[model samples]
Target: MRFYGFFRSSSSYRCRIAFNLKGIRPEFVPINLRRNEHRDAAFLAKNPQGLLPALEVDGAVLTQSLAIIEWLDETQPGLRLLPEDATKRAQVRAFAQIIACEIHPLQNLRVLNFVKENYDQDRNGADDWARHWIAEGLTACEAIAARHVRNGTFTFGDQPGLADICLIPQMFSADRFGLDTALYPRLREIRAACEALPAFADAHPARQPDVQ
Candidate 1:
């Protein structure tokens, strides 16, 4: 398996965390998003969306971070990434979507670039825009997390399932924009639990091979 991705991409970062948790080591093919390599014709041939995190496994291409994660979870059933119970699975999916759909898309590189080029916004302005959306999304997440906290650790329970996986990366990105983490104590606590685990710490952006 060859994972083509950018080191700084949160979506790719999510997949990296999943891979680490599942103990699956795939070849990392770094695509330099800084140089617009994702937009190149060769990359487009692999993923028409011109996105990072297009995984090639056994001559098959996989796109979308959530979909790729689900695939990994299903194929490697030994250590599941999602809860087995239907209701719990739904809850975890809901939490993941809050970050993946509502928050992350709005603050991603393409959206920020669009705001800069079309709205005449500067770097600080774009960062502010990102923070505004992240804070709003985290507000909702905190409420959900408070209700689901068990043993003062994981989001759904003691295990780091899908919800925790999604939460940690989003929080990492949120901190990048200087968002006040103190606003969400439950989230902060959950993040701390994940950070204590070696898998989550190893998958951190700062520890990625291409981080520098």
Candidate 2:
């Protein structure tokens, strides 16, 4: 398997954490997002979406971080990324989607870049945009998780799973944009617990092989 990703991509970071948790090591193919390599024809042939963290397994290419991670959970052995109960699994998926589907797409590189380019927004303006949406989505996530009957060092359970996999990367992005995480206590706590583990720590952006 060949993993196409960028060092600082949050989506790629999520996949990296999943790979570490699954105990599988695939060949690394670095596509520099900063250099616009993802838009290139060759890379697009593999993933027309031209997103980071496209996993080439066997003869097929898998795109989207959440989809790829879910595939890994279903196929790989080890800790389950979602709960066994269908309802509980849906809750975990909701938490993950709050970050992936809601929060991430807004502050993602492409969207933010478009905001800056077309809207003529400065770094401060763009960051302000990112912070506003991140805070909104995170606040929703915190409220939803609080309503759950979950008690653990990690989100949704005693062990880090899908929620933590999605949360950690989003928290990293929040920190990058200088958002105050103290507003979301559960999330901050979960981030701390997740980062302490070797799987999460080793997959950090700073620890990636393609760090620039």
| Every candidate's lDDT | 0.90, 0.90
Q: What TM-score would every model get versus the actual structure? A: 0.96, 0.95
lDDT top scorer: 2
- Our tally of clashes for model 1 stands at 0
Clash pairs of candidate 2? Answer: none
Q: Roughly what TM-score does model 2 have, to 2 decimal places?
A: 0.95
At residue 28, candidate 2 shows an lDDT of 96
The stretch of ten residues in a row with the least summed lDDT in candidate 2 is: 144-153
